[model samples]
Target: MFLTVTLNAALDITYRVPRLRAHSTHRVQEVDERPGGKGVNVARVLAALGKDVTVTGFAGGATGAALRNLLAADQRERPNHARLTDAFVPISGTTRRTVAVVDASSGDTTQLNEPGPAISPAEWQAFTTAYAGLLPRTTAVALCGSLPPGVPVGAYAELVRAARAADVPVLLDTSGEALRRGIAARPDLVKPNGDELAQLTGVTVPLRAARDARRRGAAAVVASLGAEGLLAATADGAWRAAPPQTIAGNPTGAGDSAVAGLLSGLADGLDWPARLSRAVALSAATVAAPAAGEFDPSTYAAVLDRVEVAPQPHAA
Candidate 1:
């Protein structure tokens, strides 16, 4: 089973406004609230793809309860698919809420994320214990998202160590100090967007510079290039997976969907090229959908044939 760890869980709230203008009173046409955090998003995608996935990390307070309830409802709604293993640990603080304002006219989204709850030392201990207990059952672990208050920057690195101890591969996805520290743990895979990749490597070049990041410790690096698709580099070789064309829709969670595709491919024993193709296809499908992280299976299948994967030279 795939295990996903979201250190800072959240209740994601998305609002649709006709035309978003700063400091203007706008009427929201639509609003949606769901369990969120990068790992949770990945798990949802994996589950939708008929994979057995379990999500674990820190959750607490009323918001946390609501998040769990929403997950339970989703599971019940899709009983024929994979199930969520009970692994989430409850803390004393309430989970965070992130707001995304989607402009209807232009389809652009502006995100406002909360700092998340302050985790106590005791809560951290519980979270760690929960994660350790599930390591044996996990075929692969995805450590995602930012570190909450009171959580150290190296928190993901510690989880990577636990996954390594259990002989399970880990996929680390985050940014800033968390990404910097997590890479030091030498995760099996790390997915960062072009901007985040540049931030981590301190180089403005695209795929060429991404290779430099892989040499630092990540066994492989999958850099998301938005409309251009993904650039992946591993010890064996490097490849670029680009979609046939760009589709206009919500771009939110596209990277997370790509991570899910990569993890699903890895769990299924797919080769690097095929994995990159799947990641590209899924991400494109997600962008074609109206909701964030939601992808149409038909669109994904159609895009699969169009994704181009070609080898790239290793940086000297």
Candidate 2:
């Protein structure tokens, strides 16, 4: 089974409007809610792709309960496909909620995030215990997203070490100091968007930035370049994968979908080129979807074969 760790699970709420303006009232055209966090999003996508995945993290309070209920509902709704297990450790503090307002006219999203509830010392210990138990049984693991309040800054680094100690291939997707530390733990892979790459490596060039990130200790690095697609640097080689054209929709979960594709490909034993293709295709499909943590099936199928994976000239 694939394992995903979302230390700060959230109830994701999305709102759609015809257009967004400053200090103006507008009618909401649609609202969608689901269980979300970087890892939770990755797990949902992985499960949709027929992978049995388990999610472990903190959940509590009404929002947390709602996230769990929604997760269960999703599992029930898709019985014939892969399964998703909610192994979240209960906590005293309430889980957080994130709001995404989609502007239909521009196809852009405005995100409003809340700092998750502060995790106490006991809660932190409990989560670590649970994470350790899940590692041995996992096929591959993904450690994702922000650290909730009161959690140590080196949490991902610690988790990466644990996963490595258990002989599991691990992928990390985060930003800032957490990522800086986690990469040093030598995860099998790291997926960072363009902004995160720039922040981590201080280089705007995708290829150079990815290479620099790899030297920081990730076994491989995949940098998401939005419409330019994914630039991957691995020991085997380096490649750039891109969709045929720009896809328009909500791009909130595109990065997570890429993570899902990469993790699933790794579990399936795919090579770097094929894995990059899948990751790029899934990311484009997700941009065509209406909400976070989902991909447009038709788009995914249509674009999967067309994704271009070209080897870089100087991979070393």
* Poorest lDDT segment (10 consecutive residues) of candidate 2: 289-298
**lDDT score, residue 62, model 2?**
98
Off by over 4 Å in 1: none
Write down the lDDT that model 1 would get: 0.89
For 1-316, candidate 2 gives per-residue lDDT tens digits of: 9999999889999889999997999899999988989999999999999999999999999999999999999889988769999899999999999998989898778899999999999999999999999887899999999999999999998999999999999999999999999999899999999999999999998899999999999999998989899999898888999999989776778999999999999989998888888888899989998656689888999999999899997854
Residue-level error in angstroms, candidate 2, position 146: 0.7
Pairs clashing within candidate 2: none
Residue 234 of model 1, lDDT score: 90
Top candidate by lDDT: 2
lDDT of 1 by residue, 75-160 (tens): 88888768876478888889999999988898788999989999888888888888888888888989988999999878988888
**Candidate 2 — what's its lDDT?**
0.92
Clashing pairs in 1: none
TM-score of each: 0.96, 0.96
